[model samples]
Target chain A: MNIIEVNHLHKKYKAITAVEDVSLVVGQKEIFGFLGPNGAGKSTTIKMLATLVSPTAGTALIGGFDIVKQPNQVRQTIGLVFQETTLDERLTASENLFFHGMLYNVGRQTLSRRMGEVLEMVDLGDRKNDLVKTFSGGMKRRLEIARGLLHYPGVLFLDEPTVGLDPQTRNRIWTFIHQLRQRENITIFMTTHYMDEAEHCDRIAIIDHGRIVTLDTPENLKKMVGGDIITLSVTDRERVKSHIIEKFGLPVKESGQHLQVEVPGGETFIPTLAVDLGERLRSISMHRPTLDDVFLKLTGKAIREESAGAWSGMRVHMRGRR
Target chain B: MRALKAIYTIWLRDVIRFYREKTRIVGMLGQPLLYLLIVGTGLSASFRMSFAPQGFSYLEFMYPGIIGMTVLFTSVFSAISIVWDREFGFLKEVLVAPVPRWSVAIGKALGGSTIAMLQASILLLLAPVIGIKLGPLMILKMVGMLFLIAFSLTSLGITIASRMETMEGFQMIMNFLIMPLFFLSGAMFPMNSVPPWMATLMKLDPLTYGVDALRNIVFAGSPAREFLIQFSMGTDLAVVAAMSVVFITAGTLAFNKIE
Candidate 1:
């Protein structure tokens, strides 16, 4: 059964269209990922689903309740962990959870029991008394997750949950998320620009320029490329380009100074190409198709290009403050 | 019942944070005490030798006004936390909660009013030092009036702060509004003696009734009672109570439209 169904949801901010004609569904107890670059309407779509941002046109349903007409029911059935940290810095971890539970009107007896269970799940039981301001970035994120789950929501929306964490911390957060999905049997909808993180989702929707480019399982999405990618840095680009086309009747795409080839088995083809090219080949590498490759093939631009712009924008904002 | 619980929890969070910050308590109290003791004593000596009215000393006259000042500052500044919460992202969490949005506004108003009342109560303990008489019934009336004053002023602050996006902008607007409200409230001078235009402004100021109500209760049986009769205790209480209701309704509506 689908827990979330969005139909042509659109959001316009002043003259800019943040989200336009976006539609998708999240199945019950499934991990659905919204994959996109910065300003690709991923966050806007999530906000509309969470009922935090009212759509300019169309609508959505959360747990069978219309997001606009039945906002309170939708809110009760879903939890949101925003992209930025929202926990009160002055409050202790448990105090923060208590405040959330109280806002949701959780019974006192059940609230305490659920608080303990969530804290344990996030491995934050021992640090429950520490002020959130004193916590590391990962700890604060974990506390926010625990707070989101305190009321036992049917669906949880996590927006870029591990954006600024170290690799080790990101892995730990993913571990907690997996455990949450397994133990609670709750539907999870998350948005992330990180390709590796998107791999963990049961299914992913690739959004670009306010449109869904593709939606499928990770394995199937990779299959759209049809084979492994072989990148070669050759001393003579024109000669290698012609040599591969004439010898194997295969197409070669030039990227900067490198030539790329798509083949059924790149590992087996590399040896014959290396022998045929002789000393003209500078270097060769082969790898399986990744979500980044999928995004690049679909949009003709690397996802990292947008990510770089986002990082610089954040840096400029921080510098302006200083 | 659930709405009440949500309001109570929000209020409790403010109170706990207030106590946790020791510097804030000292700063809020120290400035008012300095104003009461230094300004009160300095002006009283001049009035005594020059134009001291019958049965009224400047220190006794300034006591209620000082209480009003204390409550006004505390109540207005408490609403700055809303802007702070917005800047830090905590306000988003509160806005998305399952409770009604007005409950958050009501909770903040109550929290600010309770703290302001506590601060004014501490100032009340110093009444004997200024040679003012305070009967048991007068004390009860003073407490009730201060609560009304605080609630109204805090609600007004929230109404303004709800639309403010930055802490600096909120403070700028607050300073521009608060100074005029306090000055025109007849907190520092007698409304009867002011010029016609000034008296009109004083009458229009909602805080004027708050300060007048406090004065009527604090100087109930003093010789100045006859002069204070024009600003009757009943009228003062009624006006301040009405103003609190208006401010709270407006504040709730403003808070409901917040992003």
Candidate 2:
């Protein structure tokens, strides 16, 4: 059954339409990725699902509870890890978790047990008594995840969970997240701009301009191109292209020094084409298209620098620990 | 049961953290001392309120007002930490907790009032050093006054904090609301001898009721005091209790609506 059903979600900020007519359904126990570029309504949509902000026009059901009409139930059912750090620095790691458990109305005995369980899960068990302010960024992020999980929430909303971590720490967090999904049978809904991160998700909804452009599996998304890609770096010119086109009886598309031809079995036929074109080909490579290529194809622009900036910032945050 | 646990857990953590910070402890202890030393001493020499019913020294007459001032300042400023917490996002963590939202506001008020009460008691301990003497009955009355003042002011502070969206706006309201309440309540000057309209205004002021009621209890044995010590004693407490109910209700209501 679908655990989260979002229908035509709309959010506006004064003059700008942050999210417009966005809709999606996340099924039970599935790791769903809400992918988008910067300012493409990723955070705004997540905030609506998390009930941090109300939608201008939309309805979302989490675990069969409405997000707007029954917010308290919605809050109880879903755990949220905001994009920015939201833990109390003055409290110890254990204290923070214990307090979170209490706010969820967990009994004292259960709270203590869960606090210990989550601390170990986050690999911060030894630092339980230490103040959270003294913890490294990665450790703090882990603690935040632990705090959110203390209640064994049915669904977890991770908003840019690895936005500011090094690859090692990000991978570590992903490992723990995957373990939790298997161990607890929890549903995960996460938002990120990284293409590789999207690849890890079971299904990704590629969003741009405040709406979902496409929703499909990564392999299927690339398969949408319908043929293997042949990349050629040619030194010659119009004569060689016409000769190849005339001999092969196919059309050639030229982009500067490179020519792209769409034909069946391009990977198997590349050798024959290369032998026929001889010295005209300075270099040639054959490979399948990736998500970046898909993004480029759809948007007529490359993936943004904002995604790289987010990755490097997270990297610096990780290196600071060492 | 779970809600109580949460409140106590947060309360205990704050208490431990408060003690660990020696600067905060000293600052808490120091403010009451300064009031007793500077204000208590400066006004002691040749100071005689002809309106005072008894021949008690000004120090004897002003001790309870100083206690009121200490409680007033400490109790109201206790939520000042909350503004800091809100800015730092700690307040959000507490609000999102499963415990009822009123617990957050009440726990903070209680924590702040505890310090305010302690500060008031410490100010009382300095009375002998400053040469103010009171009987056992009067000492009991002083304790009663401290409780009323702390409970009332702390609740007021929490109400103000809930309405404040930013720390700057909160601080500004503190200056505009608290400072005037302190001055208009007649903590520093003689209210009865002022012009009639001003005296009526002072009488209408709640803090004025607090100060007058506290002074009457502290110096009830003196015959020369113009403030109706007996009349204010009962009414002061009733006013404080009524105001506490009003402010706490308003604070809790607003806190529930806070995102």
Work out the TM-score per prediction: 0.93, 0.83
For each candidate, the alpha-carbon lDDT, in order, equals 0.87, 0.76
State the lDDT of candidate 1 residue by residue for A1-322, as single tens digits: 7899989999999999888898888899999999999889988898888888899999898889999998888888998998788899999999999999999889999999999999999999999998899999999999999999999999999999998899999999999899899899799999999998999999999999888999999999999987898999998899889989999998787766789888998889999999999999889999999998898788877787788778869655633422
| Residue runs of model 1 more than 4 Å from their true location after superposition | A232-259, A268-284, A315-322, B48-51, B228-230
Candidate 2 wrongly placed segments (more than 4 Å): A225-288, A307-322, B1-20, B52-55, B98-100, B132-147, B222-231
Candidate 2's DockQ: 0.26
Who wins the DockQ comparison?
1
Question: Which number leads on TM-score?
Answer: 1
How well is each residue in B175-218 modelled by candidate 2, as lDDT tens digits? Answer: 78877787777776777668988878777778777877777776
RMSD of each: 2.7, 5.3
